[model samples]
Target: MTLSFFDQFMSPVFMGIPLILLALSLPWILLPNPTLRWLSNRFLALQNSAIGNATQQLFSPINPNGHNWAILLIPLLLFLITLNMLGILPYTFTPTTQLSINLAIATPLWLATVILGMRKQPTIALSHILPMGTPNLLIPILIIIETISLFVRPVALAVRMTANLTAGHLLMQLIATAGFVLMSNMPVIALNICIVLFLLSLLEMAVAMIQAYVFVLLLTLYLQENV
Candidate 1:
């Protein structure tokens, strides 16, 4: 029974091909393309406005040179939010819930920022490893610690998103199962559980949006440091 709960996390396969690719592609397919008309529909206008505001806030701390990243970062924020929200729907798979997928997305972008720093200002980038006026005996230890922390950023990003989504999904499943089992013997209790479940679902929806923003926000912070 416990294993059955975990089965939802597994990548579905059909005719020997994993459907993860399909799941990843599904979000973009649902987005409405901007029309050539002078005016856009309310939904498109709102989406554009939100993207602009978020991009402005995200890049505010970054240097002018970093403005170029808006092209990549804005789309990424939308993609993540869409995927997270879609996952909450019944029978839908969330690509971000997989640790490997999240890590794959995070590590390359994080590494790119690190590489940009090294390429643009190697001395400044390397200087982050050791602070000024350190005791000679502690110098080596501090460098090692800082280096480990630097590499751990991407791992933390991946784990944070994966763990949050996984925990929420598990809790929802547990509550749903209890509600189902209680319905026949105790309809009143089952109805209460359903109410709780409904509220919890609303909370999870908020979490889905917040986690996506948090993920993007952290990436922008990292970029700010590097740029």
Candidate 2:
């Protein structure tokens, strides 16, 4: 068969390990937020104030010595990788391939973009959304178009990821299903089809990572623009 069935279960678990490792490593290697520190202690019943202090020092994002947005990198990468793994697994679904999950990911990034924009230039945040200058006669039309596009950021993000994963996965499924249907009596032809499907699965893996990277890259670029 194309994947030996076991590969379906193994892929997501294998993919998830790096993500979990990244999450676990965050406390030791990154700087802490006092709010998160306190929350972690309270939730986990951590009693050692010295340890807490040490943990906080290690994990604090606001710390002078820590990398800016470094802590966030863990979750951001994990989320996308998890999404990709989800797409690869059989029977187990890829929620990221759905608009809902994409929206969940995209909306927050878009909000962060807005919040950062407002923080940097509150007075002109909304107005500065469009390019600096334009003809007076076209200003209103341009603003309307810009505003519409701004509102569609989440939609665009959602569609991009969902469509990519869905298309790739469906192509694989359809190809494999076709092989099975055509080669019900011919073992050799069936085997060849399985090989094609296996190759397609590999292609799907690449596509999954690419789509996730694109979404995250776009989010980063939007944030950079506002900053």
Candidate 3:
């Protein structure tokens, strides 16, 4: 029974084929396509406006060279948020809950920023390892520490998303199970649990949106340092 609670995190299979592919593609299918008309429908217009605003805010602090990344980053932001929101629905899988997927998404992007810094400004990039002023004895130790911190950034990014989603899902599942159990023996307690579950669902929805934004925002900050 305990294992059943964790089964939700596993990728579902049908006739031996994993349905994760379908889960990933589902969001794109729900999006509205552009038409030939000069004026878009309300849905498209609202989407365009939101994307425009997000792009403006994301790129404002970045250098002109970094602006080229908007094409990649903006789509990633949308994809993550869509997946997160969809996961909140019943009978849906949350890909971001998987550490492998999150790491795959984060590591390459983080590495790209690091590589860009190395290629464009090798001295400045390496200089980040050492402080402006340090005791001669501490220089080596500081470099090692900073290097470890640098490498840990992507790991932290992946873990942060995974941990937050996993915790919320587990808590929701526990509360829901309790509500069901109490419904048979204690009507009043079950009602209270239902109310708490409703509030928690709302909080989880907010978390879904906020986590996606934070992931993109941190990537932007990393790019800002490089470019």
TM-score of each: 0.96, 0.66, 0.95
Q: Name the candidate, 1 or 2, with the larger TM-score value.
A: 1
Q: Candidate 1, residues 44-121: lDDT per residue as tens digits? A: 999988988998888988999888998998888889989888888889888899999999989999999999999898
Off by over 4 Å in 2: 1-67, 123-128
State which candidate has the highest lDDT: 3
* Count of backbone clashes, every candidate in sequence: 0, 6, 0
Over 1-227, each residue of candidate 2 has an lDDT whose tens digit, in order, gives 47542233222445446333343343343333345443465523443463345335434533333234445644565457555765566656565665765797789878887787778767666765556668788888998998888889889988998878777777787778778887868888888989999898888888876776677667665665565
Sequence-dependent TM-score of model 2: 0.66
- In lDDT terms, how accurate is model 1? 0.90
Model 3 local distance difference test score: 0.92
Deviation of model 1 at 214, angstroms: 1.3
Query: Scored by CA lDDT, what does every candidate get?
Result: 0.90, 0.64, 0.92
